[model samples]
Target: MSSEKQNLKAGESHGQCQEKAEEWMQSTKDTANAAMDKTADATQSAKNAAPENKEQAAGFLQQTGEQVKGMAQGAVDTVKSTLGVGDKK
Candidate 1:
């Protein structure tokens, strides 16, 4: 403990040390506030985009379902063709 105190005295004066500590703390606080602001902005953007994203996803799913139905119909038609079941021939 005494060595620590000696080291402190040997380097910066008490006022200088206090000033540096205050500056460091201020800088840390500024960085934290900026991060918090960015997080808040990101959260708000996600909230705003949620409905649009949901609508887009729903549309995509609907298209995929339609494609699947078309593919199934095509497969059934192919089988019928091979069996000569439905064609007028």
Candidate 2:
């Protein structure tokens, strides 16, 4: 091939390589940004749910405590009646 033709071809190849590199870099940056955005959203959602979860746990514990107290009282009554120590009326 002629020298001029070879030089032209080399320049064209360099241009194509540069374009492909630019496209790859852009794609990588976009993917990283998307991943960061998803992580931020997840963190925000967890922060928002913490208080609600704590309140629910507290409510459940209170309900369970009340049920346990009732059962204990009922057992005491049963024991008293069995022993004939209950109300003498």
Candidate 3:
């Protein structure tokens, strides 16, 4: 291929990569938001139920804790992935 054609192709490739990165970032943000919302709802439900049902309230609280832990783990994993350092495979 000619030098001009090669440069054009490289530019196109770079643009595509940028676009994909943007999409990935948006998706990550969306996922984080949804996780936070779920955590908030679970916490609220647990608090409201605590006055009415002990067992059910405990379950809700447990769910909320698990959600928080999962979110933390997700954040760690995302950071590792972005830095290209972490689990292999």
Candidate 4:
């Protein structure tokens, strides 16, 4: 082939390569953006769920505290009776 024809062919090949590269880059960017959006949604969901978990934990702690108080009061009453400090009935 003539030198001019060879140069034209080379230019066309370079343009095609550049177009494919740009498309690949765009596709990669879109995939990355979608993954980021999903991650953000998951993070927000976790944040929203935390308050309910905290409330459940607080309720459990309150029940535990009440139980402990009752046990302590019972022990105190028993100790007082053993020491001959019972209230007259």
Candidate 5:
């Protein structure tokens, strides 16, 4: 009788362990799914924002180019003046 009781207890313990393992696996799956969902959402958001970002960046670059061109022209003018070549109308 004692042997039978030991066997039953061991079986029950094994079943409990299996149940816990299954629960843990399920939790891991849920976490993975949530992470995937969040990643997808972030990817979509980035895609949606890309065109606007590109346009803004292009505008900024154009403005920067204009400023640089102006500065270069000013430098050239300064150099010409320093060389006493400023009388050329």
Candidate 6:
């Protein structure tokens, strides 16, 4: 092949490689952006669920407290009955 023709072909090959590199870079950037967006959405979802979790915990604690109170009252009544210190209902 002629030198000029060889050089032209080499230049075309370099251009094609450059184009491929740019395309790869653009694809990588898009993928990175999508990943970041998904992470942000997940973070926000967790943040949104936090209050609901807290409310549920509070409700559970309240229910547990009430149960404990009832048990204590029953124990007190039983003690009084055994000791004959108070009238049993």
Predicted structure 1, TM vs. truth: 0.77
lDDT of 1 by residue, 35-82 (tens): 999999999999999999999999999999999999999999999989
Residue 21 in candidate 2, Cα distance off native in Å: 0.9
Candidate 1, residue 50: CA error in Å? 0.6
The top-ranked prediction according to TM-score is: 5
lDDT of 4 by residue, 35-79 (tens): 999999999999999999999999999999999999999999999
Model 3 / residue 80 / CA error / Å: 71
Q: What is the TM-score of each candidate against the true structure?
A: 0.77, 0.64, 0.58, 0.61, 0.94, 0.66
Which portions of model 2 miss their true places by more than 4 Å? 65-89
lDDT (Cα, tens digit) per residue for candidate 5, span 1-89: 99999999999999999999999999999999999999999999999999999999999999999999999999999999999887687
Model 2 TM-score is 0.64
For lDDT, candidate 3 versus 6, the one ahead is: 6
Show the colliding residue pairs in model 3.
none
Estimate candidate 5's alpha-carbon lDDT, on a 0 to 1 scale. Answer: 0.98
lDDT of 3 at 20: 100
> Which 10 consecutive residues of model 6 have the lowest summed lDDT?
80-89
Model 6 lDDT tens row, 1-89: 69999999999999999999999999999999999999999999999999999999999999999999999999998998889989746
Ranking by TM-score: 5, 1, 6, 2, 4, 3
**Candidate 5: where are CA atoms >4 Å away?**
none
